[model samples]
Target: DQQVKQNSPSLSVQEGRISILNCDYTNSMFDYFLWYKKYPAEGPTFLISISSIKDKNEDGRFTVFLNKSAKHLSLHIVPSQPGDSAVYFCAASDLSTSGTYKYIFGTGTRLKVLA
Candidate 1:
């Protein structure tokens, strides 16, 4: 069972505005992270992520920040555009449990970029 959950079901932002998506987890053992974005009629695509050792990771217009103490994480999209509208999901891996990684996925947050 996954202890991860998306804090918001949806978000609306004006074009060129910043969009932030949030997620929370009950387990503190998660070490690896993965962020995925999904569009209509397609599988989720990898976005960005940050490991437990790191507080933040960024790539292009995407950035992920992890707060281990609060067991929370967030994704930031800069200059949000119409093309950036999609469902974003967060997944985490816990390797300390069995030496192998087990992935836990959270619900998705739909982001709508309004023109």
Candidate 2:
């Protein structure tokens, strides 16, 4: 079973506009949720993260929101740019007291920013 899922396979937006990507998870053990941006031929890089203790986290043009009760999370990018065109992935880490931490990732959502 997929613990994390990105319902949309892809998203397109005009440059300088807002882009929103949604994700959902089924694991309640997930305490840390993260977003990653990956370009072709490159590894995914960390974007932003939100802890289950917090509802939201923002950095510059990127923001992440987590709804624990709904088991959902979303990433918002303001003023999207062409450079932002890439695959976005939602990841969650389960921090267990027994040291059974594991990271689960969504399939990924390809975002294309048109000029």
Candidate 3:
């Protein structure tokens, strides 16, 4: 089966606090991973990505870490703001594919940043 899983349906965090999201996968063949953040009704925007060759990636206030051996990954956001409230999706792709990169997304985690 294709891999990648985000178990939580939603997360609530107070503004200025840290938010953590979790994900898991079953397919070992996946070598590239990405995280996307989406506002209501809008398409997801790329947040950060990490290659299988690396264990971690960070961008501004967002960070992602991957543990290949355990098939797990996580997203971390610091100083969460109300504007940060949105749906987050975890996606993975196979690097061997050519031309196009197809992404398999998780069900989605809705993060509500409380003011």
> Evaluated with TM-score, which candidate comes out highest?
2
Which residue pairs collide in model 3, if any?
none
Against the true structure, what is every candidate's RMSD? 1.4, 1.1, 1.4
Top of the candidates by lDDT: 2
lDDT scores for all predictions?
Answer: 0.89, 0.94, 0.90
The digit string of per-residue lDDT tens for model 1 on 1-115 reads 5599997989999999999999999887788888999999999998987889999999998989999999999999998999999999999888667466767788899999999
Residue-level lDDT of model 2, residues 18-89, one tens digit each, is 999999999888999899999999999999999899999999999998999999999999989999999999
Off by over 4 Å in 1: 96-100
Q: How are the candidates ranked when ordered by TM-score, highest leading? A: 2, 3, 1
lDDT of 3 by residue, 43-79 (tens): 9999999999999898888999999999999999998
**How high a TM-score does candidate 3 get?**
0.93
Give candidate 2 misplaced runs (Cα > 4 Å): 98-100
